[model samples]
Target chain A: GQQVMQIPQYQHVQEGEDFTTYCNSSTTLSNIQWYKQRPGGHPVFLIQLVKSGEVKKQKRLTFQFGEAKKNSSLHITATQTTDVGTYFCAGGLQAGTALIFGKGTTLSVSS
Target chain B: DTAVSQTPKYLVTQMGNDKSIKCEQNLGHDTMYWYKQDSKKFLKIMFSYNNKELIINETVPNRFSPKSPDKAHLNLHINSLELGDSAVYFCASSHRQSYQETQYFGPGTRLLVL
Candidate 1:
């Protein structure tokens, strides 16, 4: 069975600090998707990386896929109060397979 | 308009009860799925359907069943629920059956089994 593991199960940072969460998969992934779920909210798709060694950015957030496609990371710079939420990384194995989601890293930012 | 909608935002029932959660997607997606998020926030896929056909069925308990009446609807029925059944159930849909497709998730149904 394929598994997606995320690090730093929980994180708390000051408003101006930075945060990063890492994800590792037991097997190579065809694609990796990142999602954010606010408190009492549904998970929302943020970005997806399919290429090896791919890097994508959305404002202050940066996402990277490892060259081997077995790991990924999400980094947030100068976190804000609105950044408080749980970040999940889901890995896709193949075309017809389902996405395996990581346990997620809960981020808490205090102003 | 809501792309994916689920009925009964919250549910609380005693043990050994039977309950159903309905999900509808107006995004015209050809695929629908059900995911359960436990108290630890671990999200796991339960079932997936494509065009009213079951495509993926995880190793879920026999007490859980999924019904897709049409391409636009997928519902989950749980029978003889137990305390371990308490979790947030989310319904999501993608434009296609491909695993790489982006998924739009509903707000989720919070079920509590006492």
Candidate 2:
């Protein structure tokens, strides 16, 4: 069974603080994607990393893929209230296979 | 204007009853998927349809069936639903490559079975 687990199931931070979430897989991943789901909303695609040891950034958000391709991390700088949401990491194992998602880290930012 | 959409954003039903959740995508993608999110917020893929053909069927119960009338539509029907079946169901679409492709999710349907 392919299991993707994330740490810090819940996090609360003040505005202007930084936040980080880590994702570890029981097995190697072919690729991994990051998604953000706002309260009462659908999950939106953020980014995807395919090659090992890959890192991608979008504005204040940074994503890193481990050399083994079995771990990942998402770091957000200067978090704001708008960043309050659940962040999920989904891993794709093989060709034609569906993505397996982790339990996500719920971020709550207070102003 | 939604890339993916599901009808009846919220559903409440009694145990043993049957219900259906309809999903549609306008992104012109060839692959569609159904995912279940539990109370703990863990998302699991239950089914996938490629080109309107059943491709991946996870360990989901046989009582839960998915219907793909076309490439852009994938409907999920649960028969004799139980209390444990209560969860948020999401519909997503992506390219058929299975990797390097991003999945777009719809506003999930929150099902409450009593």
Among all windows of 10 consecutive residues in model 2 chain B, the one with the lowest summed lDDT is B95-104
Residues A25-66, candidate 1: write the lDDT tens digits.
989999999999998999999999999999999999999999
Residue lDDT tens for model 2, B4-93: 999879999999999999999999999999999999888888998999999999999999999999999999999999999999999999
- Per-residue CA lDDT of model 1 for B22-42, tens digit only, reads 999999999999999999998
State the lDDT at B74 in candidate 1.
99
Question: Residue A93 in candidate 2 has what lDDT?
Answer: 88
Computed on C-alphas against the true complex, the DockQ of each candidate is: 0.89, 0.79
TM-score of each: 0.99, 0.96
